[model samples]
Target: MKIKKEFPSIKVNKEDQTIDVKSESNVGKKESKGKVGSEDMQNYFEQLNEIKKRVVHLQKIVRRFLKHVHVTEFRWKSVIGINDAALTGIICGSAWAIKGSCIALLDQNLKLKIRPEIEVIPSFFHAESKTNLTCILSFRMGHAMGAAIRLLTYWRGSKRTLVNKPQPLESKS
Candidate 1:
């Protein structure tokens, strides 16, 4: 049986070798030909608003954490040193490897195409005496993690919506 690419709502049962089609009129009573119903559009807008609210809430939490956290001490070693170089190399290598593995797994399992671009910017705080030191390590780490979580959430949400979208009904005579 030939499946029409234009009609994505039709599903073919491979086991029984049968095609199931639903009528488009049954989807929404007010919907006109080639046009979505007002109710459906409103529902879509509502969902988008909900998503935006959730994202804003998440941002507020992150901001609160950043504002309240206090870091007591921070030490930055020279990368020219053998130990520092080794440690940096290990950390950077491990992070890239994990990202690569995750991309590979996602591609293999979900057929997702993802290209990851990572950039690290280094910032330094210098004080005259060792006693006067204020570090923002926790804040920086929290911000990074929060951003990563937000990105993952958005990706997953979009993918889920795309994959689980309701199929439109096939027109009936």
Candidate 2:
């Protein structure tokens, strides 16, 4: 009685075994009229549909982003000349291998990963004295946003699971 007096919002109905809190929005609504099982099934389906819609939408956005994620409008290039043939050869070999590096590294896990693309443009020796090189690496903003969203979702889900218990609409009557 004291608790009810203190918290009028709490509706402890012991008859139907449902404890629903009263809000201004649901004050006059028939939230407790239907059979509990039927209502629960309906709500479960509604929630499932909502989740499916959101997940599909998220998937579409992610795929579209993966296609045009990198902005080619702005490109950074570095041109250098190495005097030593051995050093130049080593650098060229490394660049060649790395240029072919693809998203195969992270795509298997989430199919939701991004790898920055690098292009190496090598030029023949001007006078056989120096090897000219143009190396470009382009990264996209979408990768950061995708990573942030993934981390936040993982954190929210784990936190909710570890810290909260399944409460029956405030307190089960």
Candidate 3:
């Protein structure tokens, strides 16, 4: 009891404060970390997947466009009327065959329903069985022509189609 002590015990006084500051600080840090860590990772992965899907979709669209272009170009170059009358005849004949196949599968019940929309079908189909056959043949011919155009060509839209029409040659002086 006689010697005086040089060091004293440090006391943290908390009586004046309403809340514990240390606990509050720790909670804030944890919340901030949670937002930047797992949450950001989740969002990043989602965005990456979305971009991949979009790229694939765009690739398919581009491929289809290219195919259509090729078809249009081929039609312009090789088709008759659209190029030679002989080619047109062949295309119509093929379309007729396809039409026959479609009619065979569809039968009379379905044919009656579709008849109104098909105005160009031949009326001479006397046989119940032959009606669908004839209709199918007609449809096939048309479809063949479309397929030919698609396979053989590309067009620069309606303007190109208009400009390509038949024109008479003028004599020079």
Give per-residue CA lDDT, model 1, range 1-173, as digits (tens). Answer: 21112222444557655455432333333322232444545666777656555454555554554454443333222211123545555555554566567545433433222233333222222211111111222235655676657645654344434322433433211
Cα lDDT tens digits, model 2, 78-115, are 23336665666776667656544433433432333233
Among residues 3 or more apart in sequence or in different chains, the pairs in candidate 2 whose N, CA or C atoms overlap within 3 Å are none
List candidate 3 stretches off by more than 4 Å: 1-81, 108-173
Report model 1's TM-score to 2 decimal places: 0.21
Model 3 C-alpha lDDT per residue in residues 66-136, reported as the tens digit of each score = 33331111000111122444554565465566656654544431223333222122223221111211222
In model 2, which regions exceed 4 Å deviation? Answer: 1-76, 102-153, 156-173
The top-ranked prediction according to lDDT is: 2
Clash count for candidate 2 is 0
How far is each candidate from the true structure, as Cα RMSD in Å? 23.4, 24.4, 36.9
lDDT for each of the candidates? 0.41, 0.42, 0.32
Ranking by TM-score: 2, 1, 3
